[model samples]
Target: MGASDTPPFLHDAIWQERIFNGDWIAADGGSHAIVEPATGELLGRCGAANAADVARAAGAARAAQRAWAATDYKQRAQVFRKAAALLEQHQEALATWIARETGGIMPKAQVELREALAHLHEAAAMLTQPKGQLLASQEDQFSIARRVPHGVVGVISPFNFPLILSIRSIAPALAVGNAVVHKPDLQTPISGGVIIARLFEEAGLPKGVLQVLPGGAEAGEALCANPDIAMVSFTGSTAIGRRVAEVAGRTLKKVSLELGGKNSLVVLDDADPDIAAANVAWGAYLHQGQICMAAGRILLQRGIAEAVTSRLLEKAGRLPVGDPMSGTVALGPLINVRQVQRLHAIVTDSVAAGATLLAGGSHEGQFYRPTVLTDVRPGMRCFEEELFGPVASITVFDTDEEAIALASATEGCLALGVISPSVTRALRIVNRVPCGHAHVNDQTVLAEAHAPFGGSGSSGNGGRHGGPADWDEFSQWQWLTIKSEAPQYPF
Candidate 1:
């Protein structure tokens, strides 16, 4: 059956186009269209809310925040557990939507669906850990430092990995008893968001504690500027993130942003091209290179640059690209046509500036063929910018010093992968890369659920959302002191 003939499961009654206030409120104006990027077919439509609607959601979150904050950690954990189970029961539907909307292959979409559920379990487990500490003080005096939720948090997610990234922000915020107003990416909002809202509601989450507002910049701006929201957690472009930080900064609200990346993969001369190429191929092409942490830049040692690049090209050619719903596909289309054009522009500019096109570099209906470029320099669009597509820019480095310099050349510093047969060389490269996350002999995309996930520099702000440190980002530290007796002082 053709993609156009497939039923629009998204338009069903399950997605009750309403804003959560324990009851369905009609969707506000500012309508947006959802499309299947793979075929450029309309999937559904979402009701966009204006500034007033965003404020209403924020207000509801604030009211719920107070009561949720007073709930004990164990009770909060129980709710997350229920949510996890609910997702597990609905895995088939959730995975299908993830594949359809985000244009993710079945395997990758399944992985995200399973991992998202596990994340909720981990968040629930986080509740069991220590939350406060007693400081050493003078006799008969007590001092305590507690990690407390920052009331209402506004989470704005990007289009790539919608389910995973959105839930990452929401899990931590809600786990710590903070009410959250989530604004999913306008491109693929309906499917992932409707599932999330339903699961949370079925899991007995308190109404209004978590609300989904699906729209564009207008809704995002409203949520960010709301005074009731104590913090903003954003994962998108650095340009927008900077603006969000500025606006939130004026309100004195804490902001955590995981933004753009031109992340690099450094392969040493001693590395085996077979292993390095395979790992790099997966990192660069997974989800059609839509991932922000993808290794778009490859700093190859001059001795083995050709061998590694050749192997990577061979692997990239074999990956099947088609509709994400098909089980046999390895890669899917870009999230939308705009993404396809942006990636093409990056490659076109790079080639025009003297970079060599090493492999596949074509686009068709939002689908970008896996591509690699050689001789990429600092000024080229592919080298300096974030190409959120399946294009890898390879540059040869004569020495370790040169490799480190190339990795650090970009404004983004989210993650880097150092591949070397020698542990010493891998350690050296990992230490030198100026990024928040680094991997040795592996792709940068391999993230453990308990490890910190965020970036440094323009790639992100200094905050994490998926590790033991995640709770720390959504919370504020409060110090309390008690005195056993009053002391008399004489001047």
Candidate 2:
């Protein structure tokens, strides 16, 4: 998986070293052999950081934080603004790289790049806002309340939605004056990790302000255990997120998690079956359904169930599934062979349990076809678990009460979408769900760069991410006061 093994199309000359500390420093832990999900080829080898490497990265970021914090807010904003421009300029190549490396379709890959750039620009704007508040307090004294950076941020990003998910926190953490040590998923070092470091570097960001270490969970554990990392932001599975939170909690370190989701999309009786089906298709199958916000379960009112399922089957079958390198592909392969097997098993077991396998339930290597299932009941695993692949479960409900009950059944509450002819009707059903983000007349897979995106319960720790709200996780509050005149006390 080195230069000698990686195909020319997948190799990046700049990623010879996997550690960044003001410069691309070499760290000798071991080599993580990356695999191309689309073709199952050796993509490249990235350096896997050991505990000592993680310590060194933390030290570099700790030293850089004081200087970065002292830098003017406008200057910080400028860096991200430049970074955003650079990202825009390279959007095409970045999108292509993501498609080839991660088995993502071109259109969705482009969206990931666009959103990543938008996050940078949003952070730039957020940093420009006033940093402190003048308060009325204490007689004859002027009081000011201010926020400051936590000094260093340890970021752990997942493989899916590599660009946007990492940038969601990184851009804002930097904007608010924190140096960051990021660990992208071991599987996607080049597209997910190195590209981020290069963008900030090309923007003239100060050395040591940001460093990326590509590796597995051990590296992330090392980063979390480091005392210098004041805050840790993680986006991954709920199982792993709990581990991160537990480790960070031991030191009482600040932690933010954007974890797993098993969200649902509801198609009400009043909705247009055609539009609802299309939205469901996009929500469930986009990026091969790897997104945390993707709809794994789709609930429909009894009257519209057959109509919507017919439309969904038509749309799903019409969409092309092939090599992501092909421009005509609407869907691409799963991220890895393991995921393909897992998804196929889920669909197979559901069908055995009497759930109808509507569209596809087959694969060739990692290239899994878009799968749809209907008549799924609670006993079926496909109806309950978060099948983070190209599989969607459709359930029909006879009443509004039953629809809300079914949609709220999933353990994760990250997000949900409800479609109805009347917005009022949609809102009525959506409001009853435990979801953190509820959208009307839209898919569950919706997020804006400026939105405060996060969830409660199993999905997240109720921490706000994106926009200025992210500052809450990366900063600290301090109150300062001064009296114009000193009063003499009868001591």
Candidate 3:
């Protein structure tokens, strides 16, 4: 179905109808139609904003920031609590929106909603946590330092995982008393725009404190470069992230980025083949493997390589591949046809370079069957690149040294996993690597609301999201001192 033939509710959704500042308002520019990748059905449309629209949104956020910041921390936390409740109440609807908009399976979409809720709850708890610190000084003097919000934050989110990524920053930024001007991806405007804006409003969040402007590079660049925006929190590809960082840096804006990953899952000798394959399959195929921390490269110790490969092939072959909206499909569509084409190109190129296509390298519409390639060597495109799809590139290594070397040679080190019979050996491998997050006897795609999230190398700039730690990313520090006596001077 064409977007013009959209369902009434989706057609009238906030993104389709208007942008948000204090209320739903029409964009001066126009609208861009959105379609479901799974069936080429018109999902809806979002505002196509230019620099002027972003400036308008930033202006509104700026005007609202002072009053919002002055509100008590408890009051802000209360609003988040209400928002959390509202999110839970609308979980089913939100999950469906995510699935439809992002081509994620319903179960995975539901998980994203749960993660958003977890983020909201985690952000609320952050308000009651200890502020900065008290510093030791002279007997008659005392010193203190505390975090302060940066007034207005520009959140530039991505198309994939729209719900969680947008909320991941939005919740924490608001909890710390900062107004936000959000620029969600044009493709995911439903879950990222109208739904989020309405939920915050219904939760009694103050007007103008949160604004949604769905658009493309123009809007994102405007938000990043706007002098009024105190900081930017972005989640997307490394290339785009670098561009965002460049613009934000010109203004010296405080920025936090969570970029792409070409993560590794190492299968060590003596590891149980069944357990390792299970973990690897989930990490590689969940959300159709569009995750930033997916297990793109599966490294196996030569001793267990054949056994593990057979097990992984068995699991991938049996894995359900179908419509994302289906209630039971294990893997879903990629976000769009372009993404489908991109993954296929990597597979074709890798095979041309002599990589063996072990199983499943074909597509039906947006659904690409989970693919596995063996004999993938270090210099191949698939080995060196981030496929960002449900394709697993396998390479065998003779020693731990060889495995670690190959893993380290990738463009990124966002996440890594090691499976070994001994926990001690697994940890040793983890210590030898330099990724953002590591797991033993687990897959690379693990994250929680309370843990610090980021990556090293080209994965992301050295910044973290989630939990109380992100407060530093959203806020600034100020030092204060008091003295009862003022007689001594070191100079």
Candidate 4:
């Protein structure tokens, strides 16, 4: 695919320029080319914003917030309802763009589109929910505490699953009456930023209420430090998240960081080898293992380790790897050349450290085979670090206690999966691990729009999205008091 092969929907002006103050305008920082991950082909170009552009976006969001907040709740809800309908109408085109840009297969793209639509619908439902609580007050006065928007929210989303991640924050913030300035990953500007801007625009969102800027680190840092932005919602790596926190902390701005993970899936002795292997294959290799909740490590009980490993190796060897846009393959390419190199390096380093490469350990161009390593210990690079690629490292444990210990060894625990014949046995291990999401007899890589999604420790800052958590994360409480007459006070 070349520039000429760009999707027809993306030819619109909205996809080529920065969306600022409800208008499509050129960015001060010029533009950058978007390359398709699977074919290394030129997809299109999107505007790249500079610090000045971010500042301008922040000003616009701040200016529009008051009137947006004062809009009728039903009207606010209608915007999200319209956007949700539009998402359903354009699902196929959006899914194709996701596959080409993110190197995800068609099924994965469909999943992302469905989740994004759910987010919009959830945001619409949140509009009519109770917003405050009545409280008893002394001195014959009535009092209440109500939720209020943060004025301006800065949303920074990552490349993997860009549509769902970006919309989860954008829809809720806007529905709750906060203006948003979104900065999507440069690698996926069209799917993440352009699609969102167009959806809201068609839904009749007012000018200046939402601004979309596709840029790099300079723009992200500027958005964090801007005085007008009251809150920052970021989804990326922990290293960059720390920088965002540091910058936003200077002005005491609220920051929500959803970072990286090195999640684990535990297979007990009672688990069927075939079932356990299926979970491992799906959890570890889906989307080429680029998901933040991807299962990075697999812990198997000693009695069943050999059986499960054998099945897993067979499955890994059979999975087909190819370009998602060109063929129907189980696995697709990594996002870029750098990721391919990094993933290969992690596999080689682990092999050098006594890990037995059972299935795959090499790559051709950007497509890395579904690789599996057995006898991987805690100190190995693959065990301790977040390998955002198609690699699964296995370690055998003798006891449930040992399995729990091994699962919790990593610095981040975004997700955990436990497989056992008995639900009670699975719960016992799941309760012992400290993860944001836990699954029993299921894959680690799972998410729902109505669930509170976040992590503890290095994975996130205990800030959650979805359901009631959205209200807490996007709004603040304000106390109100009412009386027939002014109360006397000492002067």
Error of 4 at 395 (Å): 0.5
Root-mean-square deviation of every model: 2.7, 2.6, 2.6, 1.6
Clashing pairs in 4: none
Alpha-carbon lDDT, every model: 0.82, 0.85, 0.86, 0.91
lDDT for each residue of candidate 1 in 1-491, tens digit (9 for 90 to 100): 23343333333444544554444465674557778877777766665667788898889989988898788877889989998987777677667777777888878778888778878988898788788899998889999998988999998988888888888889888888899988888787755466677678777888889988787788888888889889999999999999999888878999999999889888898888898888888888888988888888888899999899888888877877788776777789988777888889889989999999978788667777889899988888888988888887888889998888889887778888888878787788678778989888888786656788889889888888777778688888999889988789896
Spell out the clash pairs found in candidate 3. 3-42
| Best model per TM-score | 4
Candidate 2 — worst ten consecutive residues by lDDT sum? 1-10
| True-structure lDDT of candidate 3 | 0.86
Output candidate 1 Cα RMSD.
Answer: 2.7
TM-score of each: 0.94, 0.95, 0.95, 0.97
Q: Could you give candidate 2's per-residue lDDT for residues 376-412 as a string of tens digits?
A: 9987989878888888799889988898888888667
Q: How would you encode candidate 3's per-residue C-alpha lDDT over 1-491 as one tens digit per residue?
A: 33454433333653454788878888876888888877788866677778999998899899999898898888888888988888777676667778888888887888888898899899889889887899988777889998888989999888888888898899889888899999888898878776678778877889999999898888899999999999999999999989999999999999898899789999998898888888878888888899999998999888888988899899889988777776778887888888889899999999999999988889987889989999999888889888889998999999888888877886668999999879998888898888999998889988899999998888888889877567778888989888886677889
* Model 3 segments more than 4 A misplaced: 1-15, 483-491
Highest lDDT, which number? 4
Cα deviation at 319, candidate 1, in Å, is 2.5
In model 2, pairs of residues that clash are none
Per model, state how many residue pairs clash. Answer: 0, 0, 1, 0
The stretch of ten residues in a row with the least summed lDDT in candidate 1 is 1-10
Q: After superposition, how far is residue 142 of candidate 3 from its true place, in Å?
A: 3.1
